[model samples]
Target: MEEKCTTLGKLELEAQNWFVKVIVAEKTPIRFLRWRRQQRLVFVDKENERMQSIIYEQDVDQLDKLLELYKTYHVGNAKIREITGNTPILGTSKHQMILSRSTYIKRTEEHERIPIDHIYQFTPFSELPEIADVPTKQINLLFSVIHVFPPRFVERTKRNLQDFVIINEERRALILTLWEEFLQSEAPYLTKNVHTMPILISFALKF
Candidate 1:
């Protein structure tokens, strides 16, 4: 008998004992919230549907290290949840998956049908002001790195953050801030080659 698999579109808050084969698309740095560490991730199914998953502090150490960007895995025994309180500032789906200790994720061969390319709606810098009034300030931006500053440590938030000077084709300039993992992973090379003006795309940004 063939194993059963669920797609992101078919997941519901009441469902249980579901399995999904997906590719890790985007992963956010571990952030400190209320003194606990938590991380957010976006996964893509074979149908190109995107859903966000959150790992709480307790599960972060175990699951966060196991998952890698663009890697495919078979996930099961996870919790499906309804998004509430405020509009999602990062993910595309109305529902989210919560990973716990009981959740099982097995490394799997990359599904050929699952796209590896990032799906983004790059919002222009010129349009940022127009959407500022919207309840959800989430937007995506693509820009060229003109300058990168040294990383900083905040005593208040107990976090690391870095700022990058970016510009668009229209020559509109803005400061892009990156936190946590981005500083350690991406900022080093970008800082060294700021003069070369490397292009970068950032998603789910606040205006």
Candidate 2:
């Protein structure tokens, strides 16, 4: 039988007998109001490969059942299958696939753990001499917010809006620019007692 695949990584998802050990990196509702309609889950495999999968409306129950396991356990061994009648958008099959269902999932035992700490380490901002010098082209930063700027509109082809914020960890500080969607989604927390709140930037770019 031909193998199935995933959307973001185009990784071949074999049938029930083939298992992949992964860690849940993120999970978010597709829409704030109608969460059951669709949802997104991002995972990192043992090889440090990242991929995203969507939970369709029809699979909401599966998501509900898997949520606790994913959140509490962090790591799991999952059996992946491909969904039929689903194709990549725009005809580009680069890194996208429709998975049928998660046949099985269980907490990954200690012996099954893969040493991928180097790929997801939280490094001190000061340790990086320059953003351009980051080997992986991605950095994970964790710090407390120092200041946040109000949203501003810029004259662009589509009338763009931007938001700015400053974060600090001890003596290190970094300025972050947020676009409209991010500003709106994070506005509440950004405007509150931000100095006391800590945030982790999982994938931040130097540029």
Candidate number of the best lDDT: 1
Q: What tens-digit string does per-residue lDDT give for candidate 1 at 1-207?
A: 016887888888878878888888788778787698988898887777778999997899888889888788888878888888763735557889888778888878544335666555678789989997786666777789998788899999999999989999889999888888677777888898899998876767776
The pairs that clash in candidate 1 are none
Off by over 4 Å in 1: 1-3, 87-89, 111-113, 149-162, 169-172, 178-189
lDDT of 2: 0.51
lDDT over C-alpha atoms for residue 205 of model 1: 74
The global C-alpha lDDT for each of the candidates, from Candidate 1 onward, is: 0.80, 0.51
Q: State the weakest 10-residue window (summed lDDT) of model 1.
A: 110-119
What TM-score, computed on C-alpha atoms, does each candidate reach?
0.78, 0.55
What is the per-residue lDDT of model 2 for residues 1-207, given as tens digits with 9 covering 90 to 100?
113222224345552344445666555534433444765555665455665555666666676466542332232224344543432222112243233354344555556544545336566767666665644444556666677776677767454454445555656776666665566566666667666665645344344
lDDT of 1 at 65: 85
